[model samples]
Target: MNMKRLLTVVLAVVLSTAFVIAQEKTVDGPVITFESDSKDFGDIKQGDKVENVFKFENTGKAPLIISNVAATCGCTVPSWPKEPIAPGKKAEIKVSFNSAGKMGKQNSVVRIYSNASEPIEKVSLISNVLPK
Candidate 1:
């Protein structure tokens, strides 16, 4: 082949190989798989406290490390496992809602930060608070 054609082929091959390598590297992290992304409390009475558990599993090659869990408001609180979740293992995040002064329709969000492929996941909580 001509020198110019040979150099062009070589450059293309090098770029394709580099891209493949980068994609493989990015896919090596843990993946989070949640059973459900939203929970409905249906109807709750005012001043009542309720809790729900969000289940998830690590479905990737690496261990899942959850860094933090945050709630959208003070009335909602979330708790998660402090240790790393191994591949194919399951975990749970507990969310508690205190309907102290809340009334009417309520919606809350819980943000989870982790070392997984997505890095962050959001779960939603919904309820219709009835007057006491």
Candidate 2:
């Protein structure tokens, strides 16, 4: 009877440990929430440089790490935070579009690479360049 009780206790402890491990593994990482993903510069003169700031927050359990920020074209430049954004903290991505050679309805894309729930997030910049 004592041997059976010991085996049962051991099995219960093992099962409890496995359940805890599974729960921890199921926990998710960081989540990124953006205030606005698209920005419109409206009507702008040619050769004018327009800029916009995209704000975001990390709303998850773990820290947010941004690996890279890239623009679709050279005319569009993006700058993002270098360090990790702690959970519940905010960050901004600065995007600039030079309308020097671009004309008409211009649309630019910026891609953000991160360890958030969504690995890649894209933002857009739009503008209408008027003649100088």
Candidate 3:
């Protein structure tokens, strides 16, 4: 009887831990989506700056938290909301591409980290550069 009780206790503890781990989030209750998965600036000249906004909705039950936003290239700048996104609310990510010292087929990627199931999300920007 003692062994049975002990086994049951251990099983309970293990199951609880697994549940918590599975629910671990980088982005809180929010979902990150964009108007488009990618954006094309068409033809841009060197030294020009362009920007785009990514729109998303908080589709989860809890408030979504966006921890950080980063761009793969130094020439690309990205910004995201720092505060919690309440359920059924909306959020946006603003990205800027600086054409300084860059040319040809330029590609940039932005990653967003949140307390979400899939905490890391990616977006991309692409364009062809024209000479000044």
Highest TM-score scorer: 1
Report the lDDT tens digits of candidate 2 across residue range 21-44. Answer: 888834379988999999998999
Rank by lDDT, descending?
2, 1, 3
lDDT of 1 by residue, 5-106 (tens): 999999999999999988874468899899998899999999999888999999998999999999999999999999999999999999999999999999
Cand. 3 TM to true fold: 0.74
lDDT of 1: 0.93
Clashes of each: 0, 0, 11
**lDDT scores of the candidates, listed in order:** 0.93, 0.93, 0.85
Tell me which of candidates 1 and 2 scores higher on TM-score. 1
Model 3 stretches astray by more than 4 angstroms: 1-29
RMSD of 1: 4.2
In model 1, the clashing pairs are: none
lDDT of 3 by residue, 1-132 (tens): 999999999999999999999998655455655567678989999899998888888777788898888889899999888889888888889999998888899889998888866699888888888899
Compute the lDDT of residue 18 as modeled in candidate 1. Answer: 91
TM-score per candidate, chains pooled: 0.79, 0.78, 0.74
Cα distance off (Å), candidate 1, residue 5: 27
